[model samples]
Target: MEHYHDRRLVEQTWGSSNAYTGSNYTDYPYFPTLAKQLLPNLRCVQVVEWAPMSDNVYNDGWDLKLKTPDGDGAATAAVASSQLADTSLDCMFVYFDAVDLAGHSSGFSPQNPSYMQALENVDVHVGTVLNALYARPNYANENWLILVITDHGGIGTGHGGITYEERHIWWIGSGSAVAKQQITGPDPGTYNLLGTGIFNQSGVDQAKLKQSPVQADIAVTALHHLIYETGINPETYPFWVGLDGKSWLSQFSGVDKDMERNNIKVFPNPTTGIVTAWFENPTNDHVTATMLDVSGKVVAQHNECSSTNKITLDVSGQPKGMYVLQIKIGEQLLTRKVELK
Candidate 1:
């Protein structure tokens, strides 16, 4: 968990966006004054916010606070990360508000010794912290997770507001726990693709997981997985959903030919030529059966049979390999796998 202080009021494209998202959403993407959300539990958790003002650091009638981008914000985060090896969670979320400021105020910003340049300065601070963590002997292959996102973009060049352009964010994960291939098909916001989906391939298991489309929900989901794995029951189950993530170990289990076959099963998998297909508790009414390659191209099909009950598929002439079998049981769509080998 990488925590920073005064995350907003920083000098980066994402600072304002992340802040706005955190402050706006009930859970995240929105947080108001006095404004912090905490859960009840047995483990000790501490809440800390940073500001130049020492007295009542969270004070303000929406007033401007002093900018102390150069101090404990970065150092505290680094120190906290080093302590992770010795502690369980001891979670920390810190923000060095300096970059956000530099991004907005600097005249030459982002390009020429400009605002972007000042933002780069924060990298120096981040480097020191990251280097220390990497050096810790206990940290290698620790399954450490990393995520970065921009909630809303700034005006002219920053983040705020609810436009798609503003809401666009980036996500990445690093660890032996991640999937080998990157996923890019699904769009943000709301949408669901049922059978059209292949599976949750990102290396998190479903029987033990749930996923929500809302970005704000990720934090709760992550903490739940982490805390639970660490032998601690978090105060909250996931605020939005369980992990849509899959376990990398699931891959080592390898591809389950029948595991993916589902209710409509085909026998003599890897059969050369004729293969038999059956529907579990099939109907007597006329049904349509289709055979397709993994790409969904219907290489074979039976339309409006005289009877809805079922039909035997003769795949003996086909080459040895894999194929998709689709059946129309009334309005319901069912699919199974067939082997030609």
Candidate 2:
């Protein structure tokens, strides 16, 4: 589905005040606003603190007050469950802060009873949301990718410093599209020496350390799944470029193979002038082809494509550099990389 609706619900709780109610919450590059503009079908439902309803279709006023972690989680779960049941809702981001509040109020350690209890409570809320997702009437026909992640880990009663406990965090991605393998890095050899209160990685291999996923991967992964499934390249709209993280799904067995099987063949990739693309299967939909520079600026385009399996574009006059060629046949978008030498 090229056009899909998205929802974002963040619970009002401790440690998330800045993100939910701070002055900069509605500032530029604010994700909810940017997403709404980019994805026309987006519908955001924010349960934040004191924020008025957004002017557009972005927010449905659900502003709430500070409450216990469990309470906030329950509220978020209810919103998520309700939104998930709506067939028009394609993607949803639900945030629960009870565990973080517990960690901040008490010590962030296994021995801390409050922290452990908070984790248990959040787990139940997660189950509730997942159950709602699976119970959707179109569940069997939908390809949903569920990702759970935290911003940071804590040390003792607080966090913020670049210690091992404060930096290392967990990420879980589940769904039919997700890989079955675990993503891990080489042991940093800090487990036994954690009691020493030292968090440096002097002897650790930086290359291996880079193997672990970072925070940026979450957005890229979500975008990759959306683009692959919907067959719409957001980059065609001249955005989603210059991303920091690589999609982890590409490393495992999944959509890449499926795409290759139905791949569009483009020859003379390092062409001096004209480039031709052949669709493996015939399509009756109207076709539009566009070529964009590495900076996402459209340089050339062709819109007179007929009901044929092949289309060609001429970029011989453009500067010698790499460019992306996007072919939109009805709602299915196919992309090819071209180089002018």
Clashes of each: 60, 0
For residues 1-341, could you state the per-residue lDDT of candidate 1 as single tens digits?
A: 11122334221222223332232221222111111212212122222234432232332212222223354246555554555444334233334655555545653233536556555665675566556556656666455544333333344454443344444455444434545655453453321212221222233233322322234333432353343332222221122122223222223223331222245666667667665566653555557777766433566777765654445667666655677666766655565556676
Candidate 1 local distance difference test against the native: 0.41
TM-score of 2: 0.63
Overlapping backbone residue pairs in candidate 1 total 60
lDDT string, candidate 2, 1-341, tens digits? 01111211111101122233322332213333334433445444443212232322233212222222245377778777877787876566666777777888897888999999888987998899999999999999888888788766677877655467765667888888677988776644322222322223354444653477655456556655554644543333334453334466665545453242346888788989899888843658788888877645788888854587788899998999888788877777777778889
Q: What is the lDDT of residue 121 in candidate 2?
A: 84
Error of 2 at 161 (Å): 0.7
Q: After superposition, how far is residue 121 of candidate 1 from its true place, in Å?
A: 2.7
In the order shown, the candidates' Cα RMSDs to the true structure are: 19.0, 8.4
Best by lDDT: 2
